[model samples]
Target: MQHSKLLYEKGILHNKKMLTQSQYSNFKFVARLDQIKTFTAGIKALLFAEHGAFMINEDGFTCTVEQGKCIQASLFMMPACFSEFYVDGVVHFNVNMNVLNECLSIFAGIDCTMKMLYKGPEAPLILVLEPQDECEISTECSIKTTAQEEPMEYSLDDNSSSLNVIFIRGPDLSNIFQEFDKSTEELEITISPRRPHFKIDTLGVMQSESSIEVAKSSDMILMFNCRETTKARYKSSLVRMTQKALSVASKVAIKTDLSGLMEMHFMLQDDSQAEVYIQFFITPLAEMD
Candidate 1:
């Protein structure tokens, strides 16, 4: 069999010390290159904010970025994605997203193998990269860390009225976004149970300003559920951020509560063909008097 693009073998040197005395003990954290790439690609486009929280636990790892506390983007990689995951306590660090993404993708043309480890908060993130060739070259990078910030909480709970929820194909939303007026400051989204189930209205710039609506029975809307009429406006720039995620996602779920808090769930399949979700939360802009 051909060598895998990325390799991660347990007890692979430095991380061996992370193991416990018990034979059943496993490394608290160790992951492959694919997991690293997948998680990073999911949130890279939403890293408008300078800071990102790298959180680790038994469940797996999650990278979260927030924009002025108004928009929150998260990429979650499940425990199964890691080669070995065993965390007795939570580990969190505030790291520069741009720097981290650069380090992860540094090896572009070369078939690089990686080994990742996390000792604790006091220690920096350890990454080892080796080119899969006779070069016998490997590089290790230790990224410094900072205190983690508490993430914003969004309630999509049962109590919160899910005024509107739509499941649409990624390409469909991508196409619609192309027609959005970039010159507009805000974009209006209206969802109702009536004839025009979903609508997008753009203002500013005569030619770019246009209103598009899709009926509940439209093929593009795979699923539609709206209890009552709900209308909300969001910054055109903020809503446009989802364009990247929309391109990779197979299906997209758009949800808005009564408070105008919007949640967009992107369904993505990993290398293993397992389903994973990348969620984005955007708070609607205040109404103009």
Candidate 2:
């Protein structure tokens, strides 16, 4: 809950001579975590892509990964998840997620504290980990970082006329995905104001289909708002990428706009019960003639 001002001030003063005032003020991040598992869990959820852009700000840390220019996923870690969190303005950089995950898991199954520091875009991401039970052993890792490129934009227009929103408990929604046939190639989602208010259908490779329906009066559905009947189709594989987050989430929100762009928001809690979030944006598959 407290910022490590002394450490950041010292790090800034040391780099002041090497960097210009403007450059030094642009990117500087320092975060410490007593619960290493919390950080690792978040990174592991978005490991579908090897490389991801890390955006740090006063709010917390967010890592975004995009695939095939059609699907994007982000993992958000709030300040409460860290023992010491500090950032100078907003910082953006790219990192190898696989390597970072491995480094954090090195001391797995043990109680360890982590300190992460990034001086600027050019500097490597430095990680310091020390086991709480072991006094003499410690590890320091410096992972290479790259300049961030322009990320793909995929956001739903809130003012659209065809917008639909659904809120459901995470476990209930996750059960639907878990029951899906693995051989399916496409997933179709339908939301209507009539009976069977929400439905999910899948088409398999063997010319077979599966469907699951949830009524508006169902206990699992917290809220359902639909202006009209709306349906969209997306790649089943792309939609399954949320399994990691869904396994740990407590609640989820499903939204869709007029363009058929789908957005899913998942809420998770760490060891200390601090809320964390994961978001996925998926573009609908093109219609066949």
Candidate 3:
């Protein structure tokens, strides 16, 4: 087996809307190296130890790294990760609440998390990642700066459980919008102005935007979106059927922990019955700012 390292500086991604699997289709991992870390064929156990600690520049902050400049993104750790580049010399990495939901949503297909926004990097940051074994987090660091809370958290739940959320956009199949520098990162879910019973927020998620938040109830949540009205009808019917198949699964999560059991089902057929189901699993993961 062979290992490779890549160095990315002031990445456009680190400054985009937000970085999530759903939003960023081609999520890949790259590491940095001195010369080369070679491994024999089938030797397995390819260990990638980031040379140092990591930090995410306080929101609108910045930093620079010496050697082990980084970002270790894996499904097992925090859902979303970010780093900063300052003119001085420091690299800031961080994970938070929103990123965690985005992470769980992509992996479990249902955002079923509640808390524990990761703050730093650590070995086996997540158990699921197969490549890098141990991650090194920087300690001697400081917040270079912070952005004006652009994607600030709202919704009055002291628990902030709503974050295990689903932002569903257009059944109209319209509108599309990634990032670490999430100062401007936004989640948009659109629904047809024609669709009934839809919690369509035409106000968008911003001052000049219009988006909808898919609601999760004691049982079901908006699992999928379709372009054609007929397909949505058919899919909705199938989802109802699936929900029935997993009847005991619909016991309602009053105070229950979703864990790995949350599942959302989505499928579209004809104009008759269409719907989608998103599986929600209270992930062992968390989101951070």
Say which candidate scores most in TM-score. 2
What is the lDDT, from 0 to 100, of the residue 282 in candidate 3? 17
lDDT of 2 at 132: 78
**Rank ordering of all candidates by lDDT, starting from the highest:** 2, 1, 3
lDDT digits (tens) for residues 1-289 of candidate 1: 1111121243334233333346323334555553445555675765677878878886677788888867888877777765555555677888887777677676764556566666566566767766667335666666777889888877575454556788988888889888766797778888889967899888775635678999989888989988888788888888877777787888899998667888998887677564467789999887842
lDDT (Cα, tens digit) per residue for candidate 3, span 20-52: 344222222222111111101000111121121
CA deviation > 4 Å runs, candidate 3: 1-195, 201-289
By TM-score rank, best first, the candidates go 2, 1, 3
lDDT of 3 at 257: 20
What 10-residue stretch in candidate 1 is worst by lDDT? Answer: 1-10
User: TM-score, each model?
Assistant: 0.84, 0.87, 0.18
Could you tell me the lDDT of residue 159 within candidate 2? Answer: 80
